[model samples]
Target: MKYFALLFALFFINFKQKTDKLIGRYSYLIEDNNSYIQKDKITFKDSVFVFDNKYMPKGKISYGNAILLENFINTSLVITIPKNQIEKDTIEFYMHDKNSSSANYLDEVTGKGRLIKIK
Candidate 1:
């Protein structure tokens, strides 16, 4: 019974990581003093996310890894993206620095934005 429970836990964890992968491009509309209807982009591929701003000042490029958690995706920014965030044309995420030094988030860059993805 003990070994069965351990295996179940392991399987659940592995399944979460495998299914929580972030993929493709998600964009957020940036409302600035200047006129524009369209805006920035966040591209995710192989569990990595990159930011590319087409407008707005100080449009810098940054990237971060989408670390898989048991029930969420962590980006070292304290943002917990549930599996359901992929619905519709937006991926809502919260932002706050965790300042972790773990290997999981070692390559993540610092940035923030509420993205809207076109399906």
Candidate 2:
């Protein structure tokens, strides 16, 4: 059917667009009063993303589901970390450019930081 074909095509295009942009590694540096704290890394693949921070408990790795939301020409990423061994936080990164390799990381309690795509 023509309608069925159109629906499938639209779905495929949406899926491809979402996956293509976020399949890489991003790094952010944590600092306090101009002193180096630690570096955090986030690697995204498909619908899941893995987070690594040396300051976390036992230097553990945490994972969560990543959702990319687009508004007009701007895109933002939300990573939902469930209640786990490390911590529970819903981090939202606002893209600074259309390419999305650079973003501003926002935390409700700690304010904001910069995220740069390393890979």
Clashing pairs in 1: none
Q: What's the CA error at residue 21 for candidate 1, in Å?
A: 2.1
lDDT of 2 at 90: 26
lDDT of 1 at 49: 54
Candidate 2: the clashing residue pairs are none
- Listed in order, each prediction's TM-score against the native is 0.40, 0.33
RMSD of each: 11.4, 13.8
In model 2, what lDDT does residue 43 have? Answer: 63
Query: Residue 25 of model 2: what lDDT?
Result: 67
